[model samples]
Target: MQTIVYQIKDAVYANLTNRCPCACTFCLRAKGPGVYGSPPLWLEREPAQAEIDAALDAQDWTRYRELVFCGYGEPTERLDALLAAAARRKALDPALRVRVNTNGLSDLVNGRPTAALFVGKVDCISISLNTDDPDEYLALCRPKFGPAAFPALLRFAREAAQAVPEVVLTVVGEPVTDLAKQTRCRALAESLGATLRVRPFENGTRRFPVP
Candidate 1:
């Protein structure tokens, strides 16, 4: 069976699609079928809007503080479905916060400036900054967009800050991203009106903290 929605800590996660433009070297999907011992996230097929809504409806709203659009792939790969789910969640319970964990390539993926679409649909958006160097990002992430990806990602973050309530850019801690690099990333995030979060890297997987 496909796992559409699952819980991690106080958040309920929505698994939308397995499509992503970049293939990062430290991607968790390469290490295992799941993250933090959840069910296999590789969807047999992308869930439709109805299926996604049904999954959301089934969840006990009182238990989860946030709804996150994140799974084995980039959430923006299915931008429409993601936004629809977030909108529905907000309509059902306005207090329940909604977030999207993304690679910041939505514009390239959808062929337009997509950050403005978030507006009031999502409460927060966490983007992976990875590194401060463009060459390093190209090497580490291996995005299909080649040299254009990094610039687009930065632009997206800048736009997202204006659209979303909380915009965060994250980098892995220690070995993956050193202290000096993390500091630069923090500065970069702040320049774009976003905060930086240094996620802990453990057992080859980035541990995402609950929002």
Candidate 2:
């Protein structure tokens, strides 16, 4: 069976979908069956709320410090399901920190202000800011929304910063590490009231032991 919930380090991750609007060149899906030590994430169909609740309920919640909505595809692509599952998790333990790792194209995908949906349910929102330049972002992410995706992403990040407790914009270490570019990314993130995180490129070829 495909993995619905899996461990990565100390956090538990939920795989909600394989439907994504962007075709990122560095997407982990292209690297292997799953990231770290999880099983293949390609689901036969996106899990409904009941299945997600069961998968999460099966786990010893206290064993993980955080629960993240992330997998082979964009979690917000399954917005209703994501919200339902997150609400269930938060209801179980109000103190549990819940997060979503996304491409930040959710509003564009939904054609609405999706950040508002996360307000009280999520603790953190991590957005992929692949590059500071719009053109570079388009080239790297190749979003189906086209050039408009860049601006929409920025708007989403700004809005998310207000709706969620913590908002972070991230750049992959390998492709966007020039001193000037990093500086620009940090400044832009700061302008949006968000922090910039430089994520190291993990070798997705093997199943890493969970800590």
Candidate 3:
């Protein structure tokens, strides 16, 4: 069966699509068929809105602290559905927190200023800022947008900071992202009114930073 929604620690994750604009070298999908022992995340087809809702409704919300839009692909690739689901979840439980783990490429994918649409729907937006340099980003992520991806990502993060309550730019810790580079990434994130999170690296497993 398709794993539309699954639990990871204290959060419930929504897998909306299997399409993404970038093909990062370190993407977890390359490492395995799943993450942290969840079902295979490779979706045969994108879930319909109703299916997404059904999966979400089946969850015991009280057991999770947050609802996260994350999986094998970029959640913003299904921007409308993602926002709708988040809005509905908030309506169901006003106290529940919602977040989106993104590559900060939504504006490029959607072809417009998309951050403002997140207001009132999600509490946090986590963007992967793998490196502080644009050239390095091009080489590492190989985003379809090429060189334009890095600046656009920063722009999205800046705008998102104004719209979303919590905006975080993330980088892998240590070996992949050295201390000096992390410092630069932190400065860059702060310059855009966002904070930086260093995701811990494990030998054989991929881990995402908690919101």
Candidate 4:
């Protein structure tokens, strides 16, 4: 018998595509989306909006805590798909916790302000703010928008909270494991009314391995 084992807890991670705007070296998809334990998350193609909606239709929405828009890549890379799915989820239940995990490059990818799309549709947005410094951010995130990504990301986090109800920022929690960076990152989150999350990094476990 085959069972599903997911990395994310209590929530369903909607992997819309393997495509992304940033080329973070630490991304899991750099390898592939598969089950190390059970169930299987494999991306054959970027599913269409209709396909995504139908798939969700098969699930028990009430049992899940959140519907996370994430894959091996940036969820916002397929902005329309995300919006459509969110609309459907909200239609199912207005109080459903809808979230989008992004690299904070939707504006650059879409050629316009994109946060407004989340208004009343997305409840929480989690962005990858790997560093507080532009240089470090660029070096790590490799954003397609250049150094401007740092400020833009900060600004996006601010707007996301206002557009929806909650905004969140996350770091790898290992690469920038220092008090200075943590304080600055937390301060930025505070200023934006967003929650700051420090997810565990596996230097000896996952991020870096014997090579």
Candidate 5:
């Protein structure tokens, strides 16, 4: 069966939809079948709310510290469903922290302020900042929303900081190893009142090949 929810380290990641706005050149999906040895990250179709509930209900929730709304796609692409799943998880265990790993392009994708949607439901919001310059971000991310996507993403990050307890802006280390660039990116995220997370780039060596 396709993976709807899978474990990685101390977190449980939910694969709701294989839908995303940006097509980053360094995306792990470009290199393998799945992030870890669970199942193909792809879904035949986006999972329904009932499917999400059943999956969450089946998990040994106490074994994990975080329930992350992330997979091969941008979780906020289906914001309502994401929120509902998060609320369900929270209801199941109020102490279970819920997070969404996103491209920060939801406002551009949905044409509205999507940050407020996560207010009380999500404990942390991790947005992919990618770069410090707009042109470079546009070139690398290739978001369907066009050049305007960069600023819209920053705006969403700032808005999310006010709603979620922990708001993080992330960059892939491989492409952002320059100390100066990383420093600038960190400063930029700090300016928006969000923490910067320089995540190690996965080259898919840890990924299992599809049969």
Candidate 6:
């Protein structure tokens, strides 16, 4: 019998930066990082590839159910480092399931389509669709730029739908309780052949524990 050894699934999270386009009303970091379970959200400098590699190396990848990319800020902002880590992890275990929890706004940030780059490397892409209504999205998201940032996020998800095998369009449970918006999000994701996952808003929730 081949014994399989797995490290407890590492529910690991990474903070790539403290910058984001949308300043959602529900953001825990809006006030500051240490406010909640997050100790401190401040990053003096973006760590180099070596630093990221070293951090990930210290982890027992086999123990975790999946490797997740998420933080107080947007993970895709560090596209180069992320891709390198993804490639390294995949090389180590092709069967490893790699996932990214993103706001899905990289295309707008990088001024180009960035989803295609995830092929083969990322096993799944879960993005925050947040709200179906552009106006409400703008209101809650409080994006740093113009109102256009709202739809751009949706478009990013749309583009990822065709690129990633398991694309998830997710929204938190709240003002989104509007049946119409829920229906719209579900229908749109279904039409695009992507899965729609509705997650509860993590507001004031206890720190996520490892399973």
Each prediction's TM-score versus the true structure: 0.96, 0.93, 0.96, 0.87, 0.93, 0.84
Which digits, one per residue and each the tens of the lDDT, describe model 3 over residues 26-131? Answer: 7888877778778888898999999999999999987998999998899999999999999999999989999999999999999999999999999999999989
Q: What is the lDDT of candidate 3?
A: 0.91
Off by over 4 Å in 3: 204-211
C-alpha lDDT (0 to 100) for residue 22 of candidate 5:
80
The clash tally of candidate 3 reads 0
What 10-residue stretch in candidate 3 is worst by lDDT?
A: 202-211
Clashing pairs in 2: none
List ranges where model 6 is wrong by over 4 Å.
1-9, 31-39, 174-176, 201-211
Answer with 1 or 2, whichever has the higher lDDT. Answer: 1
User: By TM-score, highest first, what's the ranking?
Assistant: 3, 1, 2, 5, 4, 6
Model 3, residue 163: what's the lDDT? Answer: 99
In model 5, pairs of residues that clash are none
Superposed by TM-score, candidate 3 places the C-alpha of residue 18 at a distance from the truth, in angstroms, of 0.6
Candidates' C-alpha lDDT: 0.90, 0.86, 0.91, 0.73, 0.83, 0.69
Q: Output the TM-score of candidate 1.
A: 0.96
Write out the backbone clash pairs for model 6.
7-63, 9-64, 10-64
Per-model RMSD to reference: 1.8, 2.8, 1.6, 3.9, 3.2, 6.2
Q: lDDT score of model 6?
A: 0.69
Off by over 4 Å in 4: 1-8, 35-42, 203-205, 208-211
Question: Which parts of model 5 have CA positions greater than 4 angstroms off?
Answer: 201-211
Which residue pairs in candidate 4 collide?
A: 3-39, 4-39, 5-38
TM-score of 4: 0.87
Clashes per candidate, residues 3 or more apart or on different chains? 0, 0, 0, 3, 0, 3
Cα displacement (Å) at residue 71, model 2: 0.6
